[model samples]
Target: MFPFPPSLPPVATESAEDLAEQSEIEYGTLEGGSTMAFFRDSKIETYQKMWRYMESKRPSVFVPTIEEGVKRVLEGNYAFLMESTMLDYTIQRNCNLTQVGGLLNSNSYGIATPIGSPWRDKISLAILELQEKGIIQMLYSKWWKNTGDVCNRDEKNKDSKANALGVENIG
Candidate 1:
């Protein structure tokens, strides 16, 4: 399960050259070997500086509700979700696949959940409402596509498909 709120790793104080050398030694790079040699020769402070620089590039994350979710989405607060595992997992659990699919299909707004549980239902309904607004679209699954149904029918169809293929008679 993803944590409710994600925590990023702290920036290390060590230098890039040191980090590179450590990475090289830990991976066992010989004197002339290609891989580790390059980083091993770099200054440790260089690596540390690079780490801090990258951390500084990250945008602050915010949690918003139905009233605020749309606004935040429009503002790009959920942009990190594109590459963040924690954010993705949280979205997956709180928002069903259909809702997320709809958001992806829509071009206007972004998606973000509120800080607590009270907003879960509201967020979900808001996504649906957003779809109605033409700002999003809730895509149905393959099964739903063919039959206009959302419930899984795998088990119901299993016996027929198996019998037709003669799998039931197999030893």
Candidate 2:
């Protein structure tokens, strides 16, 4: 019988093809079940695409909370595919886990406004102004990169390359 943490060889998870192979390894075994985790309620298009990708390959678990998925990965033999932002936050806090692979797709966040609200234009303009002045970028660097509580990841380590996930090793 396969062990709880199966004795699968280390497989590359840095590309879509690699991830597909990893999923195959997990789902091919007798005890294999749910080697990937996705948040159950996410309606974002990119997230949905990832869900479809994984589901098409094999069945995986959906966790109600992000914390559950994080915990599952920590327990081993699992991968949690999530937004780079949240993945960065979690990796900074928990050194045991690092992001695997780059983003499967790209998306942008928008400031939500009530329907027909007059403040929408004002808020949109302010966000654009911040972007133009690089305030948003500065804030992201401060919180995501330079936080005091963050784990000091080694650049030489392959898995620690979370920041450049989208740019590096695109295959």
Candidate 3:
């Protein structure tokens, strides 16, 4: 989530390089813009590299917590790159913050069962059925998307479409 008052026009991107090269916006406009970003300060080398990239060319963009990053963003002129699940949760609760792109990367999770357990196949089949019928997606929309205390922004569909998912390394 990058900070832009709900009033301003969108400046969305999925690339960290784009944000830094283009400037998260010198101060809400691209004409004479410069980098305006925040890093997650992670131990992972990729994250460190990303942070260093921003710091080397731009002002430091590292923040220790989501609250700090979000606060910085809400103040205006910043991009908070982070793990998407948490960031997306925060976005759901606020109208001021919105994701501007598609997945920078992705991972999969699965249910676990005892080895050769009968329940394993049953659960997997059930999950697949739910997926094929779109029930899981519908449930996600109902709970994660709609069940939030957001501002009165546009109440549109809130699915992560396949575009630029934004700079994952930073957000």
Q: Highest TM-score: which candidate?
A: 2
Candidate 2, 45-148: lDDT as tens digits: 44455456655645344454567667766666666555566766777777666665556445588878889999999999999999999999999989887888
Top lDDT: which candidate number? Answer: 3
Taking the candidates one at a time, how many backbone clashes does each contain? Answer: 11, 0, 13
- Flag regions of model 2 displaced more than 4 Å: 1-9, 23-60, 114-116, 162-171
| Model 3 worst lDDT window (10 residues) | 27-36
Model 3 lDDT tens row, 65-130: 667777767877766655566666777787667665444445467988889899998999999999
lDDT of 1 by residue, 1-171 (tens): 111111111322122232233321111112232222332343444434433432343222322233233233333312111212322333433322111111111124345666676877888888889778765323432222334333332445332121111232122
Clashes of 1: 11
Worst ten in a row by lDDT for model 1 = 97-106
Error of 2 at 101 (Å): 1.0
- Order of the predicted models by lDDT, top scorer first: 3, 2, 1
Which RMSD values do the candidates have, in order? 21.3, 7.7, 8.4
TM-score of 1: 0.16
In model 1, how large is the Cα lDDT of residue 119? 76
